[model samples]
Target chain A: MKHCLILGAHSDVALAIAHQLAKEGHSLWLAARRFQDLEPIQKDLEIRYGVPVACFAFDAEKPESHQAFVEALPECPDEVYLVFGYLGPHPGSLEHPTDARRIVQVNFAGAVSVLQALALAMQKRGKGAIAGISSVAGERGRKSNFLYGSAKAGLSAYLDGLRNYGYHHGFHVCTVKPGFIRTAMTAGMDLPKPLTASPEQVAKATISGLRKKKGRVYVLPIWRWIMCLIRNIPDSMFRKKQL
Target chain B: MSPFKQSISNWGNYPLTESLVYQGKERPASGPYIARGMGRCYGDSASQAQIWSSRANRCMLDFDSNTGVLTAEAGLTLDEILQTFVPRAWFLPVTPGTKFVSLGGAFASDIHGKNHHGNGCFSDHVLWIDLENAEGEVLRCSREKNQELFELTAGGMGLTGIILRVALQLHPIETAYIKQRSIRCRNLQETLEQILAHQHWTHSVAWIDCLAPGKAMGRSILLLGEHAKANELPEKYQNQALKPHSTQQKNFPFFLPGFALNSFSVKTFNFLYYHKHLPKQKEQLVHYEPFFYPLDAIGHWNRIYGKRGFTQYQFVLPPDQVDGLIKIIETIRAHGMGSFLTVLKLFGPQKENYLRFPKEGFTLAMDFPLSPKLEGFLSQLDALVLKHGGRVYLTKDLRMPPEMLMASYPQAEQFRQKIKEMDSKATFQSLQSQRLDLHL
Candidate 1:
C-alpha cells in the first residue's frame, strides 16, 4: 500500500484526502498547525481503513519547523497533498502590508519551501506525486480578490516549474485550479448556488485528477468555456466598467 | 482597486455549466462591476472586477421605446431586452446567433448578426457607455469622451473597466418573423453568385453539408430573408402576429451514447437535412428564434457531441481564397468523423479593432468531437488556412495551437500591446490565455 501525507490535515480538503487515501489502503501521516485539529480525522482514518494514521503539528510559515515536520514523520509518505492556504480579506489586506505578506507567505513562499524540500526527498526516492491547491481566481487578477490571487499565481507558476523539473525523474506535480467551492472559508459569502462546488465535490475531483496525474484540472469543467468567452473581451469595451 | 479574477481549468474545452456567476445582488465599491451580458466577449473589455463582485448595487438607468433607445443596467440581458422591446415592435439593432447573451456581453464581444452585411458589429449601433475605472471614477465615453476607450471597448473585452450602463439603438420591426426564401445552390459557384445577385436582401445565410464530397461537395441551401409585416402573416395568425412566443422549450437530458452520432448516422441525417429543403424553395414567415437558433430549440444541445464534448472549428478565408473552401471540405470529408452542424457566412468589411476576427471573407463554423485524430486534422487545417492567408475565429476555438493563434492573428502583438497598457498590472486573464500562453 502507498503512504500518503496530508500536509494541512486539519483543513477540510486535506482531511478528506486523508480519508480517501486510507480507504484506498494508503498509510497516512496527517499534519496540521495544531495536532488536535487532526485528531478526529486521524481516528476515522485509522478505524475505517485499518491502517496506521498519525497526526503531527505543522506551522507552514516557520521554515525551521517544516524540515523537522517532514523528518519527524514516523513513516516516509510516498505522496504529499498540500492543502494549506489563507484568504486575506481585501480591504483589510490592502491596508495592512503585514496581513498581505502573511497571506502570501502561507500561500506561496511557505508552500514552495515545504513542497520543494519534500520534492527533493521524493526525487531521491525516484517516484512520488505532489499535488497543490491553486485557485481559478489566479487566472486573472481581480480588484476584488487579488491578494489571494497574486499568491496563487506565484504558487501555480512554482508548481509548473517543479512539474517540469521532476517529470522524467518520475515525480508528478498536479496543480488544482478550483473555481468556487462552498466551504467554511466561503460561508456567508453570497456565491451563486449554480457556480459554487461543494467541498466534497472538490475532494472527489481532486482525487480523480490525482489518479489521472492531470497537470491541471478545473474542479468544475465549465470554467473552460466561461474563460474562453471572458478572454476575448476587448479592452476598449473592457475598460468601460467593472464586471 | 485590483480587478476581480475569473478563470477556467485546462481539462476541457467549454466552460462548465456552473462557471457562469450571474451577479445576483452584487455591486462594486465604485458601483457594481459591469454585468457581462452574454460572456461572449474575448477579453477584459467589459469586466469591472471590484465593483461587480459586491452585493447591494443594482439599477436600470433608462430606456426609451419610441426611438428603440435602451439605456439599462450593465447587467441586463439580450433576453430581457428582447422580452421588453419585441412587444413594442423593437428588436436588437444587431443580434448574434443566440439571444441568451447579455447586453454587456454583446457589447464586450462586439457581436454581429446575419444582418452584419447591412449593419456592422454591435459597435456600429452603440452610442455611448458609462465606465467605472480602477479609481472608482465613472466616465462617459462615446465616439467622444474617452474616444480611445470607446473604440477599444466597442470590440474590447472588458479590460479598460466595468460597464455600468449602455445606451444602444434598437431596430424597429413590424413582426418577429422573417419572410424567408430557401434556394438550393448546385455548388460553391452558385452559392457565391446567388449572394452577389441577392445583395439587397437584408439577411442571408447558407447551410453547407461539408461531409458531402466531390460533385455534391459545395452544394448548399441558401436562405434569403426580409423582415416580415403583420399583414403578411397567414390570416389565421395575423391578429397575434406581433405577439411574443410562449412556446415550450425542449431539452436534451444527457449525453447520448457515442456510437449514436457516428458517420453512418450523420451521413444519413445530412442527406435527409439536405433534401428536406428541396425543389429550390419555400417562402414562409418563420419565427426569429428558429431562424437564428435552430439548435436552440433543444436545450443542452452540446450533449449531442456525447460526454467527450465537442469543439467548434471555425475559420475564415479571404474572398480570393474561395479555393480553400474546396480544401476545407476535402479535409473534413477525409477526417471521416461525423459533424452535425456546419454553417457558412459571408463577412463584410473589417471593423476598426486591430484584432477583429471577421473580415471580407467566407467564414465556416462546424462542430466535431475531440477524437484522438482531431488534433492532427486541425493542425493540417490550420496549415491550409495559414497558407491561404486566413485565420481561425478565437471565440469558437478550443484546441488551436499557440503558434497557429499567433500566426493567424498577426495583429496579436498590437492587441497585446494595447491591453498591456490598459491593464499594466496584468489583471485580466482566462484559461484560453493560459492554454494558448497568450498572456505573458
Candidate 2:
C-alpha cells in the first residue's frame, strides 16, 4: 500500500481526502497546526479501514518548520496532498495588511516551501506524486474576494510550473481546481447550490487525477466550462460588473 | 459566533418555526437551548428558540473490534457507523427505521426497532454518555456511575442536557443479510396471532392495510427476520458474507402537490402493497438495507406527502388492551383516513424508567397528511389511547395536549422534578418540553 502525507489535515476537505485514501488501504500521515485535534481522526481511520495512520505537528504559517517536518517523517511518502488554504474574512481583508499577508502566505508561499522540501526528497527517491488543491475562484479575480482569489491563482500557476519540473524529474504532480465547496470554510456563505460541490467530490476528483497522472482536474466538470467562460470575459466588461 | 435567525423544521415538515440557530461544537453560554441532530425526529422535540446543532461535532472517538464496542461523538449518524463497521462484521444493537438519525437523537428517543421484542431500546445498549449540563459541566453518566442522571437522560428528549459522546455495545453478525419470512394475515386478530407465534424471531413487524373495511379491516402482512448466517447465504454471497450494501439511492426530487396523497392514492398504494405477497408464506434472504430501512432507499421520501407534510401517529397500547387497539384501527377506517405506511410491532417487557416509550404491548405507527381536520381527528384518537393506558411516541407527536403527556407517562412529574434539580435555571428546553410543560 502507498503511504500518503496530508498537510492541513484538520480542514474538512483534508479529512475527506484522508478517508478516501484510508478506504483505498493507503497508510496516512496527517499533519496540522493542532495535531492533538487529529488524534480521534487517526484512531478512527486506523480502526475503520485497518490502515496505519500517524499524526505530526505542522504549521503552514511557519515555513521554517516545513523542512524539519518532512525530515522527521520515518519514511518519505509515496504521495503528498497539499489540501490547506486560508480564506480570511473578505471585503475588508485587503485593508488589513496582516490579513492579506496571511492569506497569501498560507495559501501560496507556505505551500511552495513544503512542496519544495517534499519534491527534493521524492526526487532523491526517484518516485512520488503530489496533488495540490487550487480553486476555481483563481480563474478570475472577483471584487468580492480578490485577496483570497489572487493567492489561489498564484498557487495554481506554481503547481503548473512544478508539474513541468516533475515531468523531467520522473515524478508526477496533479493540480485540483474545485468550485465552491460546502465545507466548514464556506459554511454560512450563501453560495448557489448547483455551483457548489461537496468536499467528498473534491477528494474523489483529486485522487482520480493523481491515479491517472493528469496534470489538472476540475472537481465538477461544469466548473471547467464555467471558468473558461469567465476567463474569456474582457477586462473592461469584467471590471464593470460585480461577480 | 453569533446565533442567526433562521426558519427550521423537522423530518415531518410541520410546525415550521423561526428560531436562532447556532452551528458549532461549543455549548451556548446561556440557557433555553436544545441540541438538534439531523432533525429527523418528526416533531418539535428538536426545535427551540435557540437550537444548537451537533452535526459538525461528528467524530469517532474509539472502537474495540475484539469487544465490539464503539465510542463516538453524539453527532455521528448510524449510516456512518454502518459504513465503517458492517464490513467488519459488526452492527448496531438497535437501529430505528432510518439510519439517517444521529446517535444522540436515537438515545434521546430511546428508539426501538422490529427487534425490540428481543433486544430493547437503543439506550439499553449504550454503556455511557458524556452530557453537557446547563452550567456547561460535562458529566460522564452510566448505570454504575451517576446512576440517577443516567436513567433520567435516557429518553429525556434533549431536556436533560446536550449529549456529547456515547459509548455503545454493537452486536456481531455473520453476514449483512437477513433471513426473512413473510406471513399474510387476513385481519387484525390474525396479524396479532402471527406476531405472537413468531415471538422467537429476532425481528418482527406487520404492515396493516388501514383502508380495508369491516371483515377485511386491518388485513396485514407480517415480516419476521433473523441475521442470516454465512452458511444460510446462496453461493453468490458466500464469498463476501459480510459485504456491506453499496446500492445507489434514488432521490425523490421534489415535493408532490398536497392533493397528490389524497385518500384514493393511499388506498391504491396500500392495496398493491398487501397483495404483492401472493403466497400466504414466503421465505427469502434479504439485504439488511431493505429489511431494516426500506424507506431510506428513497431519499427525501417524506416529500411524497406533499408541501403540507404529514405526522406519524405512533402509540403503544398495553398487551391486554387489544380491544382498544381494534377500536382505534376501526376508527381510522371509519374516517377513511388512508395512512400509507401502517407499521405494527409487538414490544417485549421494558423496565419502567424516566420516559422510554417501549413496553410489553402492541405499538402501531401510521403517517397521515396534515390538514385542518387532522388536529381534531388526532385529538379524538389521543383520548382513546389515554383511556386505554397508552401514550403517543413523543418523537412523532406534534400537537398532543399537555394533559395527555401527564396522563400517559406516570413518571413525567418526577422527570420534571429531576430536570428542575439538574438545570435550576431551566436553561435546556425544546418546543416539545415547553408544550408538554416539562420545564419548570
Measured by DockQ, the strongest candidate is: 2
lDDT of 2 at B29: 66
After the best TM-score superposition of candidate 2, give how far the Cα of residue B16 lies from its true spot, in angstroms.
2.8
DockQ list for all candidates: 0.01, 0.50
Q: Candidate 2 local accuracy as lDDT?
A: 0.89
In angstroms, the error of model 2 at B228 is: 1.9
Q: Model 2: runs farther than 4 Å from truth?
A: A91-93, B1-7, B18-20
Candidate 2 residue-wise lDDT, A1-243, digit = tens:
999999999878898899999989999999999899888889878777889999999999999999999999988899999998888766225478888889889998999999999999888898899999998888888988888888898999999999999889978999999888987656556789988989999899899999999988998888889899999999999999868
lDDT of 2 at A219: 86
lDDT of 2 by residue, B160-276 (tens): 888999999999999999999999999999999999999999999999998898888889999999999888899998888887766578999999999888789989999999999
Q: How much is A67 displaced in model 2, in angstroms?
A: 1.2
- Where in model 1 is the C-alpha error above 4 Å? A1-243, B1-60, B437-440
State the lDDT at B87 in candidate 1: 77
